[model samples]
Target chain A: MAVIHTDDSGDPRLDDFRHLSTADRRPDRPGGKGLVIAEGTVVVSRLLASRYPVRALLGVERRFAELAGELAGTDVPQYVTSAETMADVVGFHLNRGILAVADRPAPLTVDDVVTGAGTIAVLEGVGDHENLGALFRNAAALGVGGVLLGPGCSDPLYRRSVRVSMGHVLRVPFGDLTDWPGGLDDLRARGFAVAAFTPRPGSVPLRELREHAPGPVALLFGAEGPGLTESALAAADHAVRIPMPAGVDSLNIATAAAVAFYELASGG
Target chain B: MAVIHTDDSGDPRLDDFRHLSTADRRPDRPGGKGLVIAEGTVVVSRLLASRYPVRALLGVERRFAELAGELAGTDVPQYVTSAETMADVVGFHLNRGILAVADRPAPLTVDDVVTGAGTIAVLEGVGDHENLGALFRNAAALGVGGVLLGPGCSDPLYRRSVRVSMGHVLRVPFGDLTDWPGGLDDLRARGFAVAAFTPRPGSVPLRELREHAPGPVALLFGAEGPGLTESALAAADHAVRIPMPAGVDSLNIATAAAVAFYELASGG
Candidate 1:
């Protein structure tokens, strides 16, 4: 691996790390290449282990040394710069001194995701990037095999989402459900029970529903306020609720999803 | 009930709601007079049901009508304002277009919180306001009777925490653990098994730990990144983990807490 030491913030070689806040906005330019950027030592290490192709790394020398084992066999360029210069190029002061950028791998297909999975999360109208990322983290922790993004879900690869998810977004497999509620039929055909989570009256409590959908299950969640639409709820094999206290609004979308994931993982 | 129509944002009567971004900072105001402000209709309804002494409400008429049932018997002044004037007083444009201010009620005692609780969440070093709030929300949803705040925990009544918790912070009972690890002893004396959550090896998986701490468990958690301190973990009866996939970092603090709370409430 080549380690280049540079003190100049304006050096053209450092352009790929320039104005990173806006770099994600444009994907056409080499510097603005829309790469999957991982910040901090933990996330950077995950990026190295992920399937995405690492382009380069920019960090203080200390962080680079911390990653010595991960970088041993890789030939990617590692740029060493002062914290001041690194902050100037990144357009903000990042407390996490190390960052790694990787090229986006080919998108996974629904079949690729569900081929060997027993449990999955299907999200609808979960537009908040933090929530989307958090759901992935929860899914990964609770043993959910994959995630299917339905309508109105944001890109999990977004920088903020990646950060909020603590880089679990890179590890969890996800694919778009382009067919709306119709795609749910595909999941049903795959020997999975679709359970839509809502707080509406007559919905089965999550604990009881788990007994019925004991096999492979797809836990469907929607955004906090406007829960799963009528069609989405109707498409599921059953509707389940977490049984919140009376007079309380629903829990945050990510929190609700976490409880559901835990319920399914614990065999409710 | 005084239903006053006010067009002027600068009216002296509306000062309680003025520049609300910084209003909570004043220490001498009601509840130290800074006013426990609730934004959005859902939170406003929660404020109405809470023991806090209501002062008045300011909102667009549509939101006022949405809160009609909650405001029925209240004699506090209701200042109806246009969305623009409402924004002017609150120091920013609030899409919810509704706000309610109330005096803080007396703090609850630790005894009050623990008296009849079957399951509770005890937190330490959880200073992040949003995390604290999220914990309370999870505690409420999962039927954790109360929360005990150990050292380094932030105030659950803080504005941002309340908002992030969707006002559940106001509903859940919480008290500070003034005696540090000693307070945990008090819980143990009350026949509650205190289980400290950690990611370290040798800690029992949460599912198995729940069986050991079967009756009236108190699940202790710490802030993200830096988990439960050595002293806090040592004070507990046993250390527990969520059985995450190997190589994955721990789940978010609130998410982990939610899973534990769910396990305890759902009879393990």
Candidate 2:
């Protein structure tokens, strides 16, 4: 590992770590670098283990010590600085104390993610970064094989998302379904049953999902309030709902997805 | 309805809504009024329906108009002001457009939450306000009868929590378990099976929980990282786990609890 000790917050070498609150937004707009950022030791460790090319790391001394074993074989530059200097460079007080940035790797294909998967998550209109990240975290813990981002979905590698996913966004294979409702047919042609989650009347209970599909399945989710559109719902092989008590509109997208993920994984 | 028109941000009637970020903190510290604050129309509406006594409201005219039906029979002062003045009084811009403050009603006992409940949630060390609120929202959506707070949990009535819960914190009954692990026994004596959620080896899988406790069940959850204490685990009738793959630690506490709540509610 190449370790460089520096006290100056203005060192151009620390540019990747600067003004992070807005820097992460650069990835989604025109002429943006689209770099994947990971925060804290746990997430940084995951980034180090991912396929993305590590650009560099910026952190304090103690965090480096904790990650020494993981850093030994890596050749990336590790910038060490004081907490105050780090705060100045980052434009916020990041108590996480460590950060890593990586260049985006080649995007995975939907076919690649689904090739050996039993259960996968496909999302539509899930623009919120934290919810997208939480869904990835839940998907990882519950053993969902892959994630296919349908239209209107946010970039899973966005900084807030990577932080919230606890860096699982780096590990989970996700590919865009750019065709919207039309693309769901691709999964069907691949012999995967598509189940869109909605609370609309006549939707089946989440518990009976296994019976409806009884094979490799794709669980489709929409954003929290607006939910799935009519065309999207019509395209799926099954419409599933986590039966809720009257008056409660719906669960947060990630929480509801976790319940469905757990149900499918447990075969309960 | 007592609709009081006031353009003055310094109006004493708006004191309950002033400097709200710090004011909410007052409830947890010494001599705090322990007031419950609700934001936006959905939450404010729920607060209006709750047993707690409403103190007053501060909002823009549009929000008041939207809530006119709910406010028709109420007599509390509604301080109408411009968005700028409302922002000045509250010390921040609250796009939620409306706010309501209520005095906490008489505290509920564990018995109150457990009574007439088919399934209940018991929490330990869940100190994060958002997590506490999310758990209550999940509990309410999934039809968990009530919530019992054990050691290390934060107050559900905290402003951030109430908002995160979408104000389900007002509707779902909750009480403190002041006796720590010992209070778990009281749940057992009442014929409610106390199943603690832990990922420890040899623990029963969450899907198997219903088989272990077919009747009334209380799903116990600990904080995300450390999990339940051994003493607390031992006190429960069953130690349950949401089965996960190797290397992943666990799900977020609220999401995990939601999975358990769905399992018990669905009887899958």
lDDT of each: 0.87, 0.91
True contacts kept of each: 0.78, 0.97
Off by over 4 Å in 2: A27-31, B27-33
Q: What docking tier does model 1 reach?
A: medium
Output the chain A TM-score of model 1: 0.96
TM-score of every candidate: 0.94, 0.97
Clashing residue pairs found in predicted model 1: B29-B32, B29-B33, B29-B34, B30-B33
* lDDT value for model 2: 0.91
Model 2 Cα lDDT, one tens digit per residue, A28-132: 545475578888899999999889899999999999999998899889999999999999999998898988999887789888899999999999999999999
Docking class of 2: high
* Per-candidate RMSD, Å: 2.4, 1.8
